[model samples]
Target chain A: MGSVDRKDILAPQPTAVSESVSPALEIVGLSHSYGSRTALSDVSFTVSPGDFTVLLGLNGAGKSTLYALITRLYAHRSGTIRVFGAAIDRDPATALARMGIVFQQPTLDLDLSVEQNLRYHAALHGLPRAVTEARIVEELARVEMSDRRRDKTRQLSGGQRRRVEIARALMHRPRLLLLDEPTVGLDVAGRQFLLQHVRKLCRDQGLAVLWATHLIDEVGDDARVIVLHKGKILADGSVPEINAAQGTPSIRAAFDRLVQHGEPSQ
Target chain B: MTSETVEIGSVPATGPIRLTAAHYLRCLEGVVRREWLRFLSQRGRFFSALVRPLVWLGIFAAGFRFTLGVSIIPPYETYVPYEVYVVPGLAAMVQMFNAMQSALSMVWDREMGSMRVLLTSPLPRWYLLTAKLLASVVVSVLQVYAFLAIALFWDVEAPWWGYLTVLPALILAGMMLGACGLLLSSTIRQLENFAGVMNFVIFPMFFASSALYPLWRVKESNLWLWYICELNPFTHAVELIRFALYGEVSWSAALVVVGFLIVFMVLAVIGYDPARGLVARRGGSE
Candidate 1:
């Protein structure tokens, strides 16, 4: 796969079945292991552009292992990742350029201001000075953090920090945003706020988002939720569809069904 | 930016924080800057880096001067003062400290959750590690120059031309130690176990090398000890610095240090490889 075309992702009108549709993210037969312990095994999925897809898994469910492979931090022994349709393994830079990632871990410099952190990230992508400053301001505003630009990241609350991370992830205005547990430390309010903001960002920016989380509440009925367990994806489909198959109306019940049965449909 | 947000103590949440290539460089740049700030914030690491070398140079060298009367080595054209002879060793000491500091920070980073942030960046691991190594080497060079300055003040002098040669020697020595540090950081599974590994690696490497005494000096005690010195990469690092400071090239020393450097770096790269889990631990995978 190459890059997902702008027309495929953004066109207001739908085409016939014969019309080609390109996915923003495509992973097939992905697997990773440390010694004999497999972290991810033959995970396959596609995230269409403008779609908000949530990856549901418990702690140690290989969400990060999959994220690592997608980012190419560690290569999977077998499988392929295509971001915006470009092969991540063959041409990582181009593939990576089209995607934004917010690691589950806090990657910010506590001592530096929020703006400085974004500036540093910008330079890594070789962004020009004027463009970086402009994007920093824009992204900060998007996260409702425009005023916190100068404050040291260390001073920010956990929720504020995660917002900064989300903003930082979007600095390049990527087509796909890969968020690994973006709300791990937040309170109920914080989690709700972050999810709402991220959902809005996807809508406003036409970004395909792969949100990894253990909380079933984070996955909406409209979003595509892939249930991962013990390194394998147990189910893949719309949350409502999966829930219906499991005879559960709520996402929490659906998740319980999937975990109990080890498959959504069965 | 509002005045409230701009307050030094205040944590601002102005607009959003965005990530780009520039942002990544800024992250690394920020790390280097913060490290310098934190390092300088406490005068302890600085003072220790300086004081330890001076203690070795002033007290130990002085006491040993009488008992360890030195003969002419091939590198030294004429008989040199014991202090003068150990200058290269002191240089190696600086490099060693710098390398250990790099390793020490890796442990600290793991503890502080900073290393995870760096690893998870979109940037290549090699580039990130290179930035760190460069910063370590630069800081090490500064410490060495400060030590040299102190040596000059103490009237322990090398040939003027030797100062120029010290630059390359410093680079090689810094790399040798820095790479070793990288390898150790990559291999050691956790910060808690780092001290044991440090003890295993640092003391042996230091004592086995010519840093404390010349190869010939050890040869008099045991031929195997002399062979150990030859095999000790730190010895070559010391020899390289020693020869360079004295306006000569020891081809064997150069070869050993460079070879050690390449091997250390290769090992480090292998250790940090994503598939290998060298530096990738399991404690904080959320």
Candidate 2:
């Protein structure tokens, strides 16, 4: 954040080994069904490094389903999810090692202290105890919950819990971060903070990010967007590209046109 | 949540990709630590686990003390008190209950989707599940030993060295029961559903086994019922503990318990497989 320029990271650097040419997340011919009801039908997309991509979808639009497949929470039944070129199913250890996720639900253990929850995650990643303690302090400080680390998660407010969750996601320094409706229940300021915080990670660290939300306003003017409706991709491009495809000037209009007609204009 | 602009430390530029034996060991240690903390927090579970077995040993055994007499069993050198006869059964009961209790928690986690946190780990799923089982076994063993210690005051005791010998038997039994719980948990979807399953599993497993009386007693009463008792894995677990407590080994019981453990553990691994097993069908949500 100090003296780091967004424009500097926006461009590719030859020296960055972390910035592999491969997409951070690549899903091809991904189809998942819950019995007869098809949740996602042939869904596919790619989130590149340093890209702030928003998965825009309404309720039951299969945004969560796509997240499930990518995160390996639910298996990829028909297609493939590759993280940093590592297929999740074939080599999940390698694939998952490169990605971090914040599930929509509050997955934190309410009974444990905030610090304990984070430590547990670190341990799962195989971090040493010495490193785990330091990382816990550092991440808690980032979420501004360092003081509340000792308190049980149940004692935290909704926004506080969300912040802790975000902190937990960063413990292992994942190259790609996936957040599903991360700001669903937060206030305006809280939501704004989360969106901006993640955006900065993209701009500053060259991290790939996929932010799934139904709120169109969260779709920034310069961000890439994937509009999912009824488990199919209606649009996948930058704000201007999506807007131009629908002959709309703004993201809201383009998203409205895409959702209202239930068809991809392009 | 703090509204202030909080600065996370600079990203590592590259995330670590290498893992070693230390990582797996750390994970195991962490799981054990979490399980121990949770066990400590749930004092009621520990209390109930002990009280339920003690009731059978104290009231149930005492009531049948004069009415029912246990003859000289191979594990027993001579006629032991009814209280003594029921000790191993009660210990096995503790482990079985612990297994189901741990299973209940797993089902809760899975239903709530919090289990995804553990499942998403870079570690092998089977290893993670085994770590969970072993952790539960540690807690179950603690309860079993505690029950044995308290039974001493009730004038029900094994040889002084029997307590030491029973450790492995207890662990093996705990693992066997825990594996069964894991296999069951993968099929279950709701917390409420677990209650019915628990009753179906725990009661029948306890009563249909040699928990209360010897298989010989059941054989004298009803031949078919005795066959069921003989086939019960809980019976083997109890016998294993009984023999181990007496500084001996029940080879047939040991083999059966070991065989079931392998079968259950393998099925559990399969049941949780996202692609091939019921895991795909269980949580059909996207």
Candidate 3:
């Protein structure tokens, strides 16, 4: 990680032509259901550039469903998802090209070497060979995994694999990054490292981030938080705003109060 | 803010980005390359695919040669050796097996989350699926040719030019079988269910076709069984290759095989549609 200067690594590349001013991600009237069960209903939110918004929800709180809708893995007929002003339904290619994702489960080909895995992603994005090679080096160096580039993915530790995934996600220089419970099984130190790195990306690169997790401690004091329960949002605002609204001193207390009562803190 | 606006080297600050034909071609090439690399790494798979057909050609064909005589068929000018007659069938069998093997990998990919990564790409889902099918077809073609070469060494030789004619027939047959495999994969929700596919799909398709004996021979023994053999798509595929291997053409067989390929490929595309497929039913969460 120390090998590359932060400024150089964070510099924006021209991957898309965005003349319109729009939120990095905007979801409106997003609803989905499986048979008789509703997973999400009339959910709406906006993540602006440079904002690190945490989607806080426990298991089956519809966090994964929302991610699925945004990513177009499961299409929702009732809602509209826009990335950088492009509607996912009407102009999915453009919207998807401007976004990056780290799914909840590990997606690496364990039999492939680290560099081969990254190269495959680069090719999928249609990056020119010269640019792909340069970005691969730069991103690998940022994750401090340059030395492990030739090693097969199965040879690396779980923390190292996560770092490689993060590096690969940045290959296309996406303006918006969506990570679904990325730190799920990591140890304390690994989780801290990943959180710090992503936070820096939001601050330095002006990249909008939607980090979904159930853990309340991951939310910083200045970060925006959306608390989702059973298929709807209980509250949405900065940490302090949520705290004051619930008459609690911490986000954890507010979360417990809201989820237990199935409403806002009083 | 101005510092943030500094343009990186060479990349334009703003321009409308449109995906071109070259981009689609690159994606196709990448997919094919990945499949090739995986095939190279798994040496056992290559050998196992070859062994199945070779065993039939070596032992089964030899044992049947003395008992079951092959008379003059459309493609054959005179009495042909049973081993020579079964060459095309066995080669097509290699393709059928390889296509299902490719489907098995898709099931595994779905379980491991790699399928999610591929589906999330900005490219159209149909294009991605077609590229995957083509990759599997290429691998099947390679295995078919390898078996042909071994059969040649064992004196089950076709005409010198017949080998050249069989290339396109093999490709078409491979695509048809591979598309069927893709359809099965999209419907199958679990890896454990794949064994059922082998029993219900692979065995029935293979045994019901003319892979083992001539249609006329079956009609002499059982008229109902002969009609089922005549209707099997694998039967047309085998006949297409058989005629090609004899430096001739079977227009009806060619048409049926091509027709089946189109139908199976269409069904595969529909089976993988996000709204109607198993992926949609599961919501892709698990």
Candidate 4:
């Protein structure tokens, strides 16, 4: 992370995201549990096209649980989750087809080269063999990882690997991108680079993003946030709205007040 | 809105949405290719998978030759050495170990591996799981062939044509064992304790079946153990492979193997299903 080259970690290059005509993700009353322990309860939210929505939460705050439900890794029994108007369980093929996800854990096969990993993803999406190579080249170039395409994932540094993962997530041309704690282990520059790249996706390409993170600083001034604490949403609104509700100067202050006092900010 | 994104979010169909056959085919190829590539890179497994069986052939066969006395079994035309009697069992052993290895890897993938990438695919869950099963089966079949070729050098011979004919039997056996592994994997909550459970399952299945000894001999000793051997699916799998390797078909064993494949596969699918599966009951992919 310390030796990360600036050239290798390029700033977000503007690219056209596939346009989304409606809200990308809609969850209503989604709740999940593990035996006696509830992970999420009656969670509801929406991310419109081109919006960078932050799912803010602390550890065990149900952010990952929310992600698991949306991604269909775990079933949500109590609520309806619609992605681009398709319910997750009823029409999973359509619901998941338009979505791209970067899980909190590193999912790349370290033994495979960067290109192989990207190619695997394209194949999973059933992307045409002809366009797969071209798409891989395009996405790799966005992360400044074109030169490292032939290198095995284990050979790359942590930041470089994260860049490749982000590239892989977008290979399907998904309109909705969900990244769960994408900046967990990266350096300051790496984190900033990831933030800028994803934010730019929302700005330049009309891509809807749900960025889940515990880091308060990741919530920017223009960000729409859904603050989740202890399996419940404490605030679901723009940064200013949350701050105003809590009579605070910033979202950080608002979140602190909400978590400490156990009061809803909205 | 771009055509690509809008096309996916179209009004939901009432029934299972159909995708092009080519799409499923390509996904299958990609997954199989990845699984094979990963299996080969871990060189230690070659030693563990092949050598253990070879040791059984080289050592156990020598010691058991006169005492255990393999009489003319249906698969063999005349009296034979323990090595020849054990080849099919060892080949099935390779497949069984391969199956367990698949289960172990799936456990790892569940928590922090490429499984996240896999489950996220728009393809149906059953299709994805079946493709993964096929991948492991392909690897296990190749391992059986490799072991057979080596067995030839050791003078533990089967008819050359048996080499070609045994493939289908090995595949059926592989799937049965693989699905069983998948079912076991779905039940396992964590990775660290899997090997212990695997040893418990594998050793019991191997010893309590016809893999290393004839069920009749066990019948001679204890009728109840023979009944248990007859009931073990691994017995059916190994017997199916044994008869096939001798260019014969054991329809009963084959049917039993197929039956177990279906049962295990259904249980595994149920175990992995997000809506009603064990995964959601336990803590999900953490």
Candidate 5:
């Protein structure tokens, strides 16, 4: 795995509007359920501009459920969801417009060429014809899949398909990117490659990011972490804050203590 | 016991559901383009749709010719051949297959995780479904017209102007079947259960309609059964085409076909609404 520098990964860049105060995404009291099953109950958090926010949880801890609500896959039964100060339900188009999402499953059509898939996404965001021609080329180049653009998705390896999916999601240049376990099916090298590229994009472009996964090792000590368990926000703070609370210096130990015993490390 | 007022997943109370037609159309167009490409890649799909009709017309109709004699119907002026009588029905049959196959694909879409991508769009669910219906209708119409051209070349002919009127008839029939497809797509949760549903829907719709023989031919058996054929929406769709090909109009058939289209479309929209959770797959770990 490639080591990404914290400074380079969290670089603060220019903002046309003042960025001293408001965060990129703000969620408050967002709760939802499936039938009698409470999937997410009163979860709340905030992600600042250029902040690499990683959500840590166990299976059935509501990471995917929260992802569903945030991306508007499954609407929230209650609570406030705001992306760049705009409410998701009030102005869903504008809220969704500001965000790029890579779903847990690969949504690319196996029958269509990689270029065709990118073109389809570009059109969905209402990109101009003149700009689309340039954007498609630039995007594929960024993911290092330019040569394979002409090939159908079924022909590509799993890692290649994942890379193409990332490239396609970035075509709109969204202010925030939501990655729901984007690296699940990738190997060690492939995962590290995607993570490095994503970290660079966030630092260079000042794009806010929410990376949800059940594994604690996926995130670094400096990144903001939220612990979700049994549809509740168990903890929300920087990694050191959680470590301090758990009486341990490492995040993995703190996470293990919180998830296994539901208490701070003694 | 009081009915439980259980509130499941819903939109945050602050934002209203606002989705414009134009934005919805764009997303729908992208999905339809992908689906069309998938359909084109499959070779076996052609055998059931394009070749199946020809087989029935050439072999079945020719064999039945010597056994059963068909009388002239409203659109026919004299003792017309049985093949000609079945052509309009065959055209309607193409539309039926188109609608159900699209529904079957929707079930497959759920299995493959593609449907969730489309549902996640910011547009309202109703508009998303309308776009899907329109795409299926367009594909169905193209296939129907292709069949018409081939039948005409074989001397199963109608008035030259009949082609123009047939356009509206095809659209009406397409919407009727397309709406039904959307309903089934919403109701069906698993892909394995689709084959049984397809057999149930397609056979009843085709055999009950005037597509195979004249409605009068069945009237001789039982007036009640004849009423069922008369009231069948597929029959009206067929009659709509039959009259259109003869350069005539059947106002009653037009009304019935249009009426069902609205009802089926409404059910499709409601069934897919997130609040209801009818089409929502059960939650699971990835």
Candidate 6:
């Protein structure tokens, strides 16, 4: 079960010329609406391998809608979403196979054990039994959840449940991991732990991560930030770049300036 | 060595992950196993599914035995007992209720966000929906068999070979009814409105069919009602089961059941299609 290496699980190989050149994820002219309500309009961004990108938005700024489009939960009428250069709409299985997502709401079955939840996900992704078992152990261990594999998810703490969900997302060895407001409802310590863990994954495993959140504090100096406001992107760059562009000393101040200005500052 | 040993030597260097036939089979197996596990854990659901049919059989059938007159039917050479005549209908009843219950579980899954986990799978939406539909059918069929066993113990007996013949019929009927439930679940957005939906759907489907009375009996009383019974897919399903349980075959009924199954399943797949589905129209609110 432990024969497979941890780094080889989901890491995009640099040796593949085609894959190495393509961004882990790219969205162009992506727009969506529900009847008259436009959730996202002309949103575009790209995340390279090993990049920890933060999608910062206020409560109704269309972050969730964007995630929905990328995950193929809802089909977008305008624009293309590509994963590892494969267009999601044209080649969904290939695109989706390279991606993993942790939605804002908890998606685990409370009645099932942590291992059971992970096993079902592995099966859905078409992982063989040997590979699934090996990856389950490796991922649970990564989240420091090896001891609670057999326990029902309902028995775990809020933070522990979130960790298990993260572990489950990794079961398929996705090169691009998308998390939507994963820190919501967690304590400060839990939030910090989760943020640090994901950041570590980006640095250690060279995986492209898109973390969407409304909280500005989740942004770090080394992270790239995409600020979304009222169905549009207002800013996209590193924290320092955003701060310099907005003439502010910090990301919070830059965020305030961007929200007040309400214009693209890419 | 610990599980974390980063041995990059044996890992495949580069290639798109390809899915095989075995993977699709495993996915189907996983979906069925999850349903079975959930059903076993929720003992109340199993017992309640049994009780509904048992109550109709034990109390309603006994009370109506003296009042209702069953004449010589095609499956029977002579007049048959009311209990015997109603067993097929009662068995179909179990499936109808179970199908609706499974649909309600889909609604619950959507509300709770597990449906999103399922939809995000790389598999085609139709295959995933079919797997889910089949899972519900398996559970419904189990309950139907349990009900049949109890009925047999209580003297509502069929031919020995009839039991074996009825298996295919039960599966077809279960799939048709379960597909209808899937269609409802996909279209009906709010869980709060589900009870009203269930009442509007279940009672009409059960009462307007040949489940309770023969089509001729319904025609004798009301011509329009008889037309509804004849048109009802549930009626065809019930007749198919009845014929099979009598060591006979109803090709017309079988055809109707198969046709309805295909139609309902196609509509169900369309209803769950991510591009034009209710979930898409609502923009993932549920």
- DockQ scores for all predicted structures: 0.14, 0.41, 0.39, 0.39, 0.21, 0.43
lDDT of 4 by residue, A166-252 (tens): 999988788789999999899999999999998887777767789999999999987888899989998888887788889999898
Please give the range of 10 consecutive residues that has the lowest summed lDDT in model 4 chain A.
Answer: A1-10
Q: Is the docking of candidate 1 incorrect, acceptable, medium or high quality?
A: incorrect
Across B1-286, the per-residue lDDT of candidate 3 in tens digits comes to 2324322212221232466676677778878877887898789999999899989988999898999989898798889899988999999999999999999999889887788777877777788899999999999999998999999866988889999999999999999999989988988989999999989999988998898889899899999998999989999999999999978888999999899889988888777766666677676452
> Once model 5 is optimally superposed onto the true structure by TM-score, how far is the C-alpha of residue A41 displaced, in angstroms?
1.2
Chain B TM-score of candidate number 2: 0.93
The residue-by-residue lDDT of candidate 1 on A82-137, one tens digit each, is 77556766656556666788888787877677987787666555565677788888
Per-prediction fnat values? 0.20, 0.47, 0.35, 0.50, 0.24, 0.47
Winner on DockQ between 4 and 5 is 4
In model 5, the Cα lDDT at residue A158 comes to: 85
Off by over 4 Å in 6: A1-20, A263-266, B1-17
For DockQ, candidate 3 versus 4, the one ahead is: 3
After superposition, the stretches of candidate 2 with alpha carbons farther than 4 Å from their true spots are A1-20, A263-266, B1-18
TM for candidate 6 is: 0.93
Model 5, A1-266: lDDT tens digits are 11223342333332234543355688889988777887888887787667788888877788888877777666676898988767777667667766788888888888889988887776565554556678789989999999998999999988899899888777767767888888887898888888888888877776778888877778876777888888888777788778888898798888887877763354
Residue lDDT tens for model 5, B256-277: 9999999999988877766555
Give the CA lDDT, 0 to 100, for residue A97 in model 2. Answer: 73
The interface root mean square deviation of candidate 3 comes to: 3.0
- Tens-place lDDT digits, model 6, residues B192-229: 87888768888888899878877788899999988888
Q: After superposition, how far is residue B65 of candidate 4 from its true place, in Å?
A: 1.0
Candidate 5, pairs of clashing residues: A76-B10, A77-B10, A90-B15
Better of 1 and 5 by lDDT: 5
After TM-score superposition, what is the CA distance of residue B284 in candidate 2 from its true location, in Å? 3.9
Greater DockQ among 2 and 5 belongs to 2
The count of residue-pair clashes in candidate 5 stands at 3
For model 3, residues A118-237, the per-residue Cα lDDT tens digits are 888876766666777898899999888999999999999888999999998888788789999999899999999999999988877777899999998999888788899988988888
Candidate with maximal DockQ: 6
Q: Model 4, residue B166: what's the lDDT?
A: 93
